[model samples]
Target: MQVKQVETETEQKQAYHVRNTVFVEEQKVPAELEIDELEKEAIHFVGYEDEIPVAASRLRFVDPYGKLERICVLKEYRGRSFGSQIIKAMEAAIREHGFQKSKLNAQTHAEDFYQSLGYQTVSGEFMDAGIPHVTMVKEL
Candidate 1:
C-alpha cells in the first residue's frame, strides 16, 4: 500500500473515481457535491493498495490557509487507517506549499478521527451536502 501524489491525468481520474464511488455512489451525495469545478486548482492525492485505488482527497488552497476537502475511502478500506494516511499526506503537501495552517469541514461522525490527528473544532456543527459537519483546523 502506498500514498502517492497524483501527478498524471490517469491518476487524477482514478482519484475522482474513488471519491465518486464512496461519496456519490454509496453515500448518496449529489454528483455536484462529489465532483467540483475547483478540481483543476486543487492538489489531489490517491492512496493505492497495490495499484488499486482505495482512498483519495484533495487540497484546495482556497484561503490564505489551505483547506482539505473531498476526502474519501473505499468501503473495503474503511477501519484500516487509509483515511488517516490520506490526511497526513495532504498535510505534508500543505506544508510544502508553505502554509503553516490548514482547515477542513469534517463530517460529524468523523470529527473524533480528525481530532485524534490534532485538529480542533472551530465551529458548531452544520449541514453540508446533507451531512452534519463541523469546521476543524490544524497548525503545521
Candidate 2:
C-alpha cells in the first residue's frame, strides 16, 4: 500500500470515496458537515492498497500549525495501519510546507491512537458532529 498527496480531480474523488464510506456512511455523520467548505484550501491525501483507495486525510495550514482533518479509513481497512500511514504522510506534508506543529480534533474513542502517534491531548472533551472529541497537538 502507498499514500499519495492528491494532485488531480480523480485522486481527489478517490479520497472523498474513502472518507464518505467511513464518516458519512458508517459513522452516520452528516454529509454536509463531513464535506465542508475548507476542502478547497486543504491538501488532501489518499492511501491506496492494490490500486484501490482505502484511506484518506487532509491538512490545512492554519496559523501557527498544520491542522489535520477528515482522516478516515474504509471499515475493512481498519486495524491494518492504514490510519497511521495516512497520518504520517500528512505529517510529512506538513513539514514539507515548513510547519513546526500539527493539530487535530480526535474522537475521544481514538485519543489513545493519536497519543501513540505522538499527539498529546490539549483540551477537554467536546462534542463534534454529536460525537465526543478532544483537541490534540504534536510538535513536528
Candidate 3:
C-alpha cells in the first residue's frame, strides 16, 4: 500500500469515500456523526493499492499528542496491512511536527491490532459513534 497525505480535493474525496464505506455504510454509524468540525483543521491521509484508495485516516495536533481519527480500511482490504501502513505514515507526519506521542480512540475490536503497532491502552472502554472504543497511546 502507498500512503500519502491528502493534498487535493480529489485526494480528500478518496479519503472520505473509504471512511464512508467502512464507518457509515458498513458499521451503520450516523452520517452526521461520521464527519466532524475538525475536518478543516486535521491533516488527512489516504492509502492507495494499485492506484485504488483503500484506506484513510486523519491527524490532529491536540496539544502534546498527535490524535489519530477516522481511521479505516475498506472491508475488502482488511488484513492486508494497509491500516498499519497508513498509521506509520501518520506517525511520520506527527514526528515531522515534533510530537512525541500519538493517541487515538480505537474501536474495541481493533485494540489488539493497535497494540501490535506499539499503542498501549490508556483508558477503559467507552462509546463513540455508537461503537465501543478505548483510548490508546504510543510514544513516537
Candidate 4:
C-alpha cells in the first residue's frame, strides 16, 4: 500500500471516488456536501493498495494552521490502518507548508480513532452534514 499527495487531475478523480464511495454511498452524506467549494484550493492525497485507489484526504491552509478534511477509506480497505496513513501523509504536507498545527472535524464515532493519532478534542459535539462531529487538533 502507498499514499501520495495528488498532483494531477487523474489523481484528484481517484481521491474523489474514494470519498464518494465512503462518504456518499456508505455513510449517506449528501453528494453535494461531500464535495465542496474548498476543493479547488485544497491539497488532495490518495492511497492505493495493489494499484487500486482505496483511501483519500485533503488539506487546506487556513492561515495559522491547516485544515484536514474529507478523510475516508474504501469500505473494503478499513481496518488496515490506511486511514492513519492518509492522516500522516496530510500532516507531512501540513508541515511542509510551514503550518504548526492541523485540525479536523471528526465524526463522533471516530473521535477515538483520531485521538489515537495524537489529536485532542477541542470543541463540543456539533452537527456537520447532519452527522455528530467534534473538532480535533494536533500539533504538527
- Name model 1 segments beyond 4 Å from true: none
lDDT score for residue 120 of model 2: 97
> Measured by TM-score, how close is model 4 to the native structure?
0.97
Better of 1 and 4 by lDDT: 4
* Model 3: how far residue 53 lies from native, Å: 0.5
Candidates' lDDT values, in order? 0.91, 0.94, 0.95, 0.93
Best by lDDT: 3
Question: Which whole-number lDDT from 0 to 100 does residue 78 have in model 2?
Answer: 87
Which model is ahead, 3 or 4, in terms of TM-score?
3
List candidate 4 stretches off by more than 4 Å: none
Separately for all candidates shown, the number of backbone clashes (residues 3 or more apart, or on different chains) is 0, 0, 0, 0
26 Cα displacement, candidate 4 (Å): 0.6
Residue range with the least summed lDDT across 10 consecutive positions in model 1: 57-66
Residue lDDT tens for model 1, 1-140: 59898999999999999999989899899998778788888889999998899999999886667899988999988999899999999989899988999999999999999999999999999999999999999998
Worst 10 residues of 3 by lDDT: 75-84
> Which RMSD does model 2 reach against the true structure?
0.6
